[model samples]
Structures are given as C-alpha cells and as structure tokens.
Target: MASNAQRRDVTRERILKAAARLLSEEGPSAVTTRRVAHEAGLQPPALYRLFQDKDDLLDATAEHVFAGHLANKLTTAPSDDPVEDLRAGWNLQIGFGLANPYVFGLLLDPARARDTPGQAKGLLILAERVHRIAAAGRLRVSEERAINLIHSAGIGTVHTLLALPPERSDPHLADAAFEAIARAVLTDEPAAPAQDPAAVIASFRSLLPDLPNLTEAEAALLDEWLQR
Candidate 1:
C-alpha cells in the first residue's frame, strides 16, 4: 500500500495536471476547485486539503507551467558572446509569455509573484545574464539597474502584446522594445573605449595580474594607479 504522503503527492500531481489542462483548454474560468477535483478523480475537499484556496491552487499551477518554460530555457546552448546570450534569453522570455498567456498572466502579476519560487528562478536567470554582460565590460549601467530596465521592458512588451487581439498584435513590438532597452543598458561595442571610465578602470584592474612583462609589485602599483 502507498504511504499517506505518497498518496498525497500523487493526488497533488493529478490535480495540477488536470488544472493545467483545463487552464490551457478553457482558460482560468474552467479551473474551479470542483472542476479540477472532478477532472483529477478526487473529491473537492481534497483540493482544500492540498491548497489553501483557489488562488493558492492557481499559483501552484502557474509555477508548474513556469518550470517547464525554465527547463527549456536552461537547455538552450549559450552563445559565446554575453550580449548575444542576453538577447537570446530576452527572446525566450517573450516567446514563453506570448505562447502561454494564461500561465504568464498569473506569473507576471506583482501580487502573485512575491515568494513564488518559479518567478524567482526566472529573475535569477536574468540577473546572471546581466552579470555576464557587466563582466564582459558591455553593460552601461549597474547590474541591478540593467536587470530592472530589461525586466520592465520585457514584461511591458508581453502585456502589451497579450492585450491586443492576435490579428492586431504588432510582430515587431518585442524586438523593438528589446533593441531600445539594449541600447540604453549596453555599450555599442564590447571593448572599453565606449565604457564608463570607472567601469573600464575596474575591468582593467581585474586583468592586472595577467598583464605580460609586469612584475607583481609593478602590477600592484598599476592597480593603485587605476583605482586612482
């Protein structure tokens, strides 16, 4: 016989799968506790035992959808250039949101996103991508600022597109928003000449030890000069 915990797990998975199917097929209105429970072959009371309420169940369902999107994102082979990697990530995010409007709507809600593990994971991935651009000396702003700008633009783009009827949606909106944000946050080139002086100095300071023909003491002195 299955343990109580094992049975609970099985029931929870069934509820989630059934709810997800309902959400995709008939949108959010069809995911009522009674409907989901019926679809899962469980009693309605089982849903109450598993989830705090309808909102909780919906959040769980959204997390499930986001997990699949994130998995696919992770499998994408990263590009050699950090800027290219950032662009790829942005495209992936926008694509997922457009393709899964119901789930994306729940995931993007500021009220629902707090404390959501799946949403947090998505933000962390974006942060990592921004950090890579900063390390490459291509970021024009602080990493936090870059992340905020990019995330805001992406979310806005998705919401805008989703608000429009499919036939009326502008195909170029996502790319335009991406390019505008990229121009604001990133240097035109990867090299340092266009970078902020402080960022350039900091980047060069990091490379001090690898400088050819520089003694340790000389490199230390150069580092001090760069810091000044």
Candidate 2:
C-alpha cells in the first residue's frame, strides 16, 4: 500500500500529466474533467473527488505552468550588471515559451485569461519586474513601455510561428527573431553605438544552438533578414 505522501504525489502527477497531454493536443477546450479523467485512468466521479471542478482543474494547470515563472518568487539569476540580468530573464522567458507552447498559448488567450486570475496575476507580476527595473532609470524606455513593447513583440512572434505549417515553422528561427528584437530595444545606448539592424539580427541567430530538426534550406530562410 502506498503511503499518504506517495499516494498524494501519484494523484497530483496523474492529474497534471493528463492535463498537459490534453492541453497540448486540443488546447484548453480539450481539458474537460471527463477527458482528463479518461486520460488519467480515473472515473469522472473520481476526478471530481480530486478537483473541485473543471475550472479548478484549469486554474491548477495554469498555476502549474507559471509556478516558477511569473509568480511572486520569480526566478531571476543574480547579475552585477542590471542590463545583462534583464536580458537573461528575457531569455529564460523565451525558453519557457519554447518548452511549453500549450501553456504559453493558454496564458496568452484573452478569453481564458479573463476566467483565470492566476494568469492575470502572473502578467501583473512580470509587469512589476519591469516597473522596478525602469524605476532605477536603467532602461532605455519607461518600465511600462518596455513591458508593452516586449510583450507585444513576443506574442506576435510566437503566434505567427505557431500559425505556420510545420514545414514553414522553426522554433529556433522564432527564438532568433525575438532575441534580435529584444537586444535592439534593451541594449544600453552610451556603452553601445547605434544598433545596426543587420547586426542585431545576426546576434539573434548567433545565440541559437544548432537544431537537429531544421533543414538547411528552411534554416537559411529563417535566418534571412526581416524586410523593412
């Protein structure tokens, strides 16, 4: 017989794993209580015993996705240089996005976000981080402005990449594009000369590790400079 701790752990894992799988395949709508219970080898009645309801389950999944990310205990690596620290944080965010596109999608969905305070709170937390950095006068743009800029650009890039056919999509390319735009906007001016648009983009591509799935031609296309 499993200990109480072990039983609880097993149940939580079963729920989370089922939710993740359903979310990945069908977005949020696919994650009904019945579906999750089916996926987890639990009866619908048993699933209710585990969670309050479908909304509660969805809330838990949202929280699980953002746990280490935008929560109160945000994961910012210490850096003597503030600019570098901010850049690293941004990279970490992009990494999170790549690692969990489904959760990322849910977080960005306006309809679902309205129903989940956890997702809204996560954004507020991220905004506060930007606010703090801006208050130090260390940013090129105001904190709120900076956050809006980055947030809009990041969401746009992700959405566009996701919409493309798999043959046309390259996550590495998307990452590179975001990095370039981020560097252009975030780099301090006095220490750095005017950013060369081409150089900013090149820097983005340079940061990408080699990808196994990307074809030479597709990779080349992804690497091409953005049009004016």
Candidate 1 colliding pairs: none
Q: Write the per-residue lDDT of candidate 1 for residues 47-99, one digit (tens) a residue.
A: 99999989889989989988988998988876879888998899999998888
In candidate 2, the residue pairs with backbone N, CA or C atoms under 3 Å apart (3 or more residues apart, or in different chains) clash, namely: none
TM-score of 1: 0.82
- Against the true structure, candidate 1 has what lDDT? 0.84
Candidate 2 lDDT by residue in tens digits, 1-228: 999888877887788788877876777898898889889998788677678988778767766767745653465545555555555655666667766777887677776665456556656755655544443334454444566777777677667766789788775765576567556555443222254443344334433336568788876677553221
- Number of the top TM-score candidate: 1
lDDT for model 2 comes to: 0.64
Query: How many Å off is the CA of 33 in candidate 1?
Result: 1.1
Strongest candidate by lDDT: 1
- Our tally of clashes for model 1 stands at 0
Residue 143 in model 1: lDDT: 69
